[model samples]
Target: MKILFLGDVVGRAGRDAIVARLPGLRRDLAADLVVLNAENASHGFGLAPDMARAFLEAGADVLTLGNHAWDRKEIVPYIEGEPRLIRPMNYPPGTPGRGATVVDLPGGRRALVLQVMARLFMEPLDDPFRAAQAELARHTLGASGSVQAIVVDIHGEATSEKQGFAHSFDGRVSLVAGTHTHVPTADHQVLEGGTAFISDAGMCGDYDSVIGMQKGGASIRFWRKVPSERLAPAEGEATICGVLVQTDDATGLATAIAPVRVGGRLSQALPS
Candidate 1:
């Protein structure tokens, strides 16, 4: 199975770039499934239902969320109803939406998509390691009739935490890709145990800005520590940042992992 996992979509620029490029990307990559982090899709904080729908229409099979999942109060109900939309599994027990979902892919194959937030430099929540173990036990990875591929989206701030989570789930899941930092890491490789892991997948937005936000505004806020006006997406060229994973159908293990960067100042690597 071939799966494409995109990082956070920041704002209008991000959305436009994805919509403009993803269809061709899917075909070029021979992707069977596509998962995207939409937590920052709407003006860089929380996804609105409309934006979420746009992402799905633009070829995202499932949408994942992170700490900003609740930024839009109106999306709570939609999140609960939309099976393709997932929030952090480690959120408190009574949280509004689901943390994972089983989605059927082409050729009757199934993929289990799970999202969890790390505790380091993040909001306190249920232990992600425990949450992942419990969820994996319930899904029964590699079981003959179970899901063929398991993909995890770990949204958090620390690379160490993301790496730890990836190692813990090695050989148990097809891929473990990180998000939320909006800065793609150089490391991309299949783990010894067959899981594809990346510390961060980066964001789909302006490359000219500071982490996808307007540089001028972000600079002021960072330098002054005073609450500046609302941050906006940078104008100019946009890009899509993500990881592409190739997994085996029989064992649900990753065979290859590659970083995907399309458009922007970053050197481009065509999907494969």
Candidate 2:
């Protein structure tokens, strides 16, 4: 299974890039499943239903959200009707949308995609580990099992927590990629148990600013401890960042993983 997992989409810049390039990306990478995190697609916070529809139409098989999942109140009703859009599984019991979804591909294969949020320096939610374990227990993985691949997006602030969560489910899932940090890390590698992992996939937005936000306003909060103008996303050329994982057909484990960065400021990286 070839799985492509994109990190957070930070604003109009990110949304535009994905809409314009995702079709070619899916073809170029030969991705069987494409999962994207668009929590920040709307003015740098929360995703709008229209944005979700655009992403899905542009080849994203599933969309994931983070702490700002409900920032756009309209998404609540939209998400209820869209099974492809998911939020963190650890959200309290009565949360609106689902946290995981199973996508059946063209070749009669299925992929399980889910997102979990970390508690360290993040919103206090249900135990992510337990939440994931409970959810995963329902599905079997492998060529002959219930699903051919499993992808988990760990959205949070601490890299330590992301790494820990990836390790905890190392052998069970095909890939465990991180998001929310918006800065791509160079630690893309397959674990001992065959799971592909990266501390972060980075945002699909402009890199010239501060983690996709306009530097001037974002930096103001650091310089002074008072309220400042609303922070907006940098509307410059965007660099679409993500990771592509190749999983073994029989075992549903990752055989190779590569970082993908296209356009804008970051050094280009594409599967060869």
Candidate 3:
């Protein structure tokens, strides 16, 4: 299975870039499934239903949310009906949306996509590790199993926590990708157990600013140590950042993992 997982989409810039380029990327990469993180798609906080609809129409099979999942109050009802859009599974048991989804592909193949939010320096949600384990227990992987590929998104602030979580389930999943840091890390490799891991997939918005926020306002906060207006997404050309993983059909393990960066200020990187 060829799975493409994109990082968080900041605002209009990120949304526009994905809608314009994702279809071609899906075709050019021959991706079987495309999952995107869009928690920050609405002015850098929360995702709007309209934005989610645009992403689904642009070839994203599933959309993942992070801490800002409920920033937009409108999403509560929309998420109740949309299984393709998921929030962290570790949210209280009665969270509005589910934490995982199973997508049936052609040839009867199946893929499981789930997201877990880390607690370190973040929300004190339920135990993500236990939540993931419980969820994985319900599904089987492999060519003959219930699912052919399992993609886990560990949205967190600490790299150590994400790495630990990935290693814990290395052999059990196809890929364990990270989000929330908004800066692409250089380490994109296949783990010994065949699971692909990256400290972060980076943001899909412009990189010229501070993690996709306007440089001036974001910088003043650091220098003045005070509130400097609300942070907004940089409207410059966005560089779509993400990862592409190829998993073995028989074992449902990752065979290769590669970083994907296109346009904007980042250097170009593609599977080819």
Give Cα distance to truth, residue 46, candidate 1, Å: 0.9
The CA-based lDDT of model 2 is what?
0.96
Supply candidate 1's per-residue lDDT for 76. Answer: 97
Q: What is the per-residue lDDT of model 3 for residues 1-272, given as tens digits with 9 covering 90 to 100?
A: 89999999998899999999999999999999999999999999999999999999999999999999999999999999999999999999788999999998988999999999999999899999999999999999899999999999999999999999999998999999999999999989999999999999999999989988999999998789766799989999999999999999899999999999988999999998
Q: Global lDDT of each model?
A: 0.91, 0.96, 0.95
lDDT by residue for model 1 (1-272), tens: 89999999999889889888999898889999899999988888889999988888988899999999999999999998999999999998898989999998878789999999999988999999999899999875553758989999999999999999999999999999999999999899999999999999999998899999999999898689778899887866788999999888778999998889999888887644
Sort the predicted structures by lDDT, highest score first.
2, 3, 1
How well does each candidate superpose onto the true structure, as a TM-score? 0.97, 0.99, 0.99
Model 2 clashing residue pairs (backbone): none
Could you tell me the TM-score of candidate 3? 0.99
Worst-scoring 10-residue span by lDDT in model 1 = 138-147
Residue 260, candidate 2: Cα error in Å is 0.2
Cand. 3 Cα-lDDT: 0.95
